[model samples]
Target: MLTEEGKKRRDALDAEITERIAAFKVEQRKMLEELAEIGIHVEMVNRLPNLPTSDYVQALPILIKHLRREYSEGTLASLARSLAAKDASEYWDELVAMYLASAHRISTGPGNLAMALAAAVAAACPKNRLDDLTNLVKNQRLPHRVLLLTPFKKRRGRDPAVARLIEELRHDPALAKEIGRWKILPSQASLRSH
Candidate 1:
């Protein structure tokens, strides 16, 4: 069960993993320090590493300021979610700008920055902003358009404007294929539930 070569390899692998973990911790500490300089305290950042545990009221302006700054995908997603949790409705335009600017870099996944931004917009966007949301869905390229349409899923049932937008998209030949493939958006039945 313990050939010398196998033991050596396992030990080497363990050492590499340990080194990587230590390096990652160092990077996190540096990032935290840099963020602290910009007014994002470590406690708020810690609460936002995953789901937001509390509202970062004092840190909201700083967080919004850095929302569009270059950062790792995970960090961006966390920031978006934290903003959404705080109901940053007043910064809706800024959030939409960030979402649109980052559309090209968005990856297809559940916990990605794009998804978080979509959720943030959904949480913060007002009735008057429906036109902007509709325009985004209509203008964005495939996949991104579909992803952008997702936020409406939560609203389609309750908001007549969102329902109309979904109806319009359903009839668009260009988007039919991509939208049909994923089927992640709200269905007609759900839309009728309200």
Candidate 2:
């Protein structure tokens, strides 16, 4: 029950989506390859947690602790990005806690794993949990003296939770100095182009 134009448009969109998925898988494979080169192996969970169980909640702290000891900061950051892509909402609180407890091991600069973790927190944590998330980052020295003030532009634009979190940081007196250190480049430009 579709018009000819509508059917054509739908087909085009499907093709585009398929291409995007293929590109993403390539990038993920590269990340996994790099992790392998460093001897950091991930035994992917058979099922990613969708509901927050007490056991799942408890496993996070232990996992983060073990990851920090076993991998370099760069490897840990890459792992965070890969996990965030899995849409693991149930683990946002644990991710924030992990960052707070071991942020010293995370390195800085754009595309930092901490930023990806923050994005997961932004996408998953409810509004009421925003303050807790913000406080954790603040207490952790805002993790490398810079934070992504806005979510990276995507097909859907910025996630609302991350936007709210960014707003919260904007008003914090303690973070005023650290926040000032971040420089955002226009999305169209790459570092090499600048």
The alpha-carbon lDDT assigned to residue 38 of candidate 2 equals: 49
- Note the clash tally of each candidate: 0, 0
Model 2 stretches astray by more than 4 angstroms: 1-69, 106-116, 137-140, 144-194
Candidate 1 structure quality by residue, lDDT tens digits, 1-194: 97999999999989986765454445356556666775566643425645443434555666676666665565567678777742577889988887876667746332477767766776667767777877877874523455556567667666767666776687667656755554444555465455
Please give the distance, in angstroms, between residue 150's alpha carbon in candidate 1 and its true position after superposition. 5.3
Clashes of 2: 0
Which pairs of residues have clashing backbones in candidate 1?
Answer: none
Clashes of 1: 0
List the candidates' TM-scores in order. Answer: 0.58, 0.38
Among these predictions, the greatest lDDT belongs to 1
Poorly placed runs, candidate 1 (over 4 Å):
1-49, 52-54, 106-112, 142-147, 171-194
lDDT of 2 by residue, 1-194 (tens): 98999999999989986765454444445444444454444333212233333324434433444344434444455445434422445566676666566555445422355664554455545445555645655563655424323222221123554444544464577556654454433432232153
Global local distance difference test of model 2: 0.47
Candidate topping TM-score: 1
In Å, residue 77's CA in model 2 sits off its true spot by: 1.3
